[model samples]
Target chain A: MKKYGSLIGQLVIGALIGFFGMLAVLDGDFRIDLSPYAYPGNLIILAAAAVLAVFSAYRYVSIRNLAKQDLSGEEEDAAEGRMYRHYADASLASTLAILFSLASMSLSLLTTQPLWLLIFGLVLIAFSFIISGILPGLMKNMYPERDLPSITDKKYAEKLLNVSDDGEKHIMLGGLYKTHITMNSLLLGAIVLLLFYSIASDSSQLFSIFIIVGILAITNTQYQFSIRNK
Target chain B: MKTRLKELRARLGINQTELAKRAKISRQTVSLIERGEFMPSLLIATKIARVFKEPVEEIFQFEEEELK
Candidate 1:
C-alpha cells in the first residue's frame, strides 16, 4: 500500500508538531506575552476548537460516504482492493482528526494558560470520541465477518487458495508484513518512552503526549490486525 | 499483451461477473484483462484457464512487439 503515503505523511507532520510543542513547554520561557488577564485570545482558541470539532464531524461523514461507494457490485478482487483503498482513506481522515485534537492539546501545553489548556483538552476529548468510537464502529460495519471456506466448495477453494502466492505476490506481501511489524514495534517503543518521560517529568502536560502516542499505537495495531485477518 | 477473454467468455455464454466469480477474482480485473488494460499474474491466468478448461496460451497471447 504505497497508496497510504499521504496518510503516513500526515502522521509524521503531526508527530513533528507535537515534538515542537514539547520543546516549547520544556524551554519554560514564555514567549509572545499576552495580558494574563485577557480572555479574548482564550475565547478565540475555544472557538477554533469548536470549529475543528464541527469540521471533523463533517469530514467523518464524508469519508464514510466515500467508502460506502466502494461496495457497489463489482468484481471480488477489485472490490477487495477498493475496500483496502477505503481503509487507507478512512485512516488518513482519522489521523487528521487525531491531529486536530493533538493540536488543541499541544496549544494548551504551549500557552500554559488554564483556559486555553482546558479548551484544548476538550478538543482532544471530542476527537477521541470520534476516532475511537464512531470510526471503528463504521469500519466494523463496512468489513463484517465472513464464513470460513468449507471442504465442500473444494473447486472454488482450490482456485482461491494459490492465486495469491505467486512470486510477485510473495515479495509484495513480505514487504508489507515487514513494514507493519517494524512500524508497530517503533510506535510501541515510542509509547513506552512517552510513558517514562511523563513519569520522569512529573508533569500533566506530558500526559497529552502520552495519550496521542497511545492513540497512534492503537491505530497501528488495528491496521496490522486488519491486514493479517483480511 | 492481448487476450481472447471476451471472445472466449462469449463463447461460453457467460458474463464478466460469472467468469470473475468462478475464477475468484474481481469483475473489474476481468474487464481490465479483456480490454488489455491489465495483465493477469500467472496464478490468476492459471485460475481463469482452469475455469474454461483451456490452456493459458489459448486465452492469452503476446503480440510480436510485446514479445520483443
Candidate 2:
C-alpha cells in the first residue's frame, strides 16, 4: 500500500517512454532486424535483457498472488498484515519490471536493435501501468464485500480509540510502525548509494534511475526477510 | 489473553456488528476481540465491559503462561 505512490510514478515514466517508443515504431524508425549484431558487447546486453525480462515476469506473477491473498481470508488483522507484507513484494516486482524494460532499451540503443527496445519498453509500460498500478484494485474488486468494518464510521472510531489505548494493541501498533520506518530508512540509504554509484559510472541518466529503482526493490525483499527471520 | 466476548454478546442477543456499533469500534475489531486474536486497550476493554454491564476482569482474563 505504501509503495503505490512510487509505483504510480514509475508507471508514468514507463508509459512516457513507451509513448515515445511507439511513435518511433509507427514512424518506422524502429525496425526488427533479425540479423544478430554478432558482437560480444551486443551479446552480453541481449543476455542481460533476457534475464531481466524473465525475472520481471516472475516477480509480476508473485505480486498478483500476494495481492490476491492480502484481500482474501477471515482474520482482519491477518489480512492487514498480509497487505503490509505484499506492499514490499509488489514494490519489488514493479522495480524488476521497470528494470527489465530499461535493460531492453539499453540493449536496443547499444545494438540498434529496435525490436528488442520497443518490445521491452511496451512491456515495461504494461507492467508499470496495468500490473502495478491497477491490478490490485481490480483483483480486490473480485471480493466486493469486505468483512472488516470501515474505520471511518463514528462507532468504529470509538472502538479503535478504545483498542488503541490498550497496552498490548498500542505496543503492537507501535512495533509495526517502527519496523515500517526502519525499512523505509534502509531503502532510502540504498537509493542514496545507487545515486552515488550512478554518478560515478558511465550509464545514462535513465539507466542510473532504473538501477536505483532496482536496488530499492531489492531492499523491500531484504527488509521482509529480516523481519521474518528475526 | 482470553475474553468472553462471544459468550457475552450471545447472552446479550446481539450480533458483532451491533456490538461493534455500540462499542464504537469496527466490526472487524470486535470480531477480532471476540476471537481473542487481538488485545484491546484498557479503555476499549472497560468500554466493552461497560456495554455488558460487567467488570473488565470478568470479561477478560490474562493467562500467566501467555504473559511469559
Candidate 3:
C-alpha cells in the first residue's frame, strides 16, 4: 500500500483532470480562447526557453570538463556516474528548449505578434539544435574506450543498442514494455472520450478517432511483429 | 535475487562505476543489482563473477520462492 501511495495519488489526480476535461468538451459554451493572453503566454514561454537553454549549456560544460579530468580514487568513479546523469539532463533540457521555442514561434506566427519574438525563437531553435548535435560527441568522450557511432550514422540506433550491455538492455526492455502498455491504455481512453465528445458536441471527431485507432493498431502490430520471431 | 556485489566491491575498495566498468555494464545496473531491484542475466552474472573472481552462485543467492 505504501509503495503504491504515490501511484494512487497520481491516478486520482489524472481522473479528476480527465473528468473536468470531459465536462469542458461536453459543454457547448466552454471554448478555449488564447487570443487575449497570447502575448503574456509567449513571454512566459520565452522565459522558460531561455532558462532551459542556460541550464543545458551549464550541464554541457560541466560534463565536458568532468569527462576531460583525470581524477583518481573514488572521485573518478563518482565523476563517471555524475557525467552520465549530467549528459542525460543536458540532452533532455536541450530537447525541451527546442520544443518550447518552436511552440513560441508557432504562437507568435498564428497571433501575428512582434517580429522580435519570432527572431528570438529562431535563434533559440538554432542554439538548441547545435547543442543536440554535440551531445552524442560528449557521450563518446565519456566512453572513449567504446566505439560509439556518430548521431549522423544511418544505423546509429541499431549500433547503439548493440553496444549496450545485457543489463542495460534489460532495463530498456522493462521501460519500453511499460511504455507500450501505458500508451495503449491511454489511447483507448482517448478514443472513448472522442466518441463521447463527437456524439454530444457539434464537431465530429471521427477523423481524430480514426487516427488514434490507426495508431493503436499500427503500434500493436509493430510490437507483435518485432517479437514474433524472437 | 540478493547479491553480494556491494560487499565484494567494498572488500575490493572499488565503487559501483568501477565495478560496472570491470563487468562491462552500466553503473546504474550495478546499483540496481546491489539494491535487489534487478536480477542480472546469465552473461552479466558471469561477467560480474569474473570481475570479483567468484562463482555466480556465491555472488547471487535466490530464495526458493524467487526461483519458482
lDDT of 3 by residue, B27-47 (tens): 778877887788888989999
How high is the lDDT of residue A142 in model 3? 91
> Which structure among the candidates has the greatest TM-score?
3
lDDT of 1 by residue, A6-118 (tens): 88998899789767767755665443334463355555645555565555566556656644563323344355455545555555555554555565565566665667466
How much of the true contact map at the interface does candidate 1 reproduce, as a fraction? 0.04
Docking quality band of candidate 3, CAPRI definitions = medium
Model 2: per-residue lDDT, tens digit, A70-147?
432234345543444454555555566666556556656556554755675665556554545543443233223433
Candidates by TM-score, descending order: 3, 1, 2
Higher TM-score: candidate 1 or 3? 3
Q: Whole-model lDDT for model 2 versus the true structure?
A: 0.59
Listed in order, each prediction's TM-score against the native is 0.42, 0.37, 0.80
- Which CAPRI tier for candidate 2? incorrect
Q: Calculate DockQ per candidate and list them.
A: 0.22, 0.14, 0.50
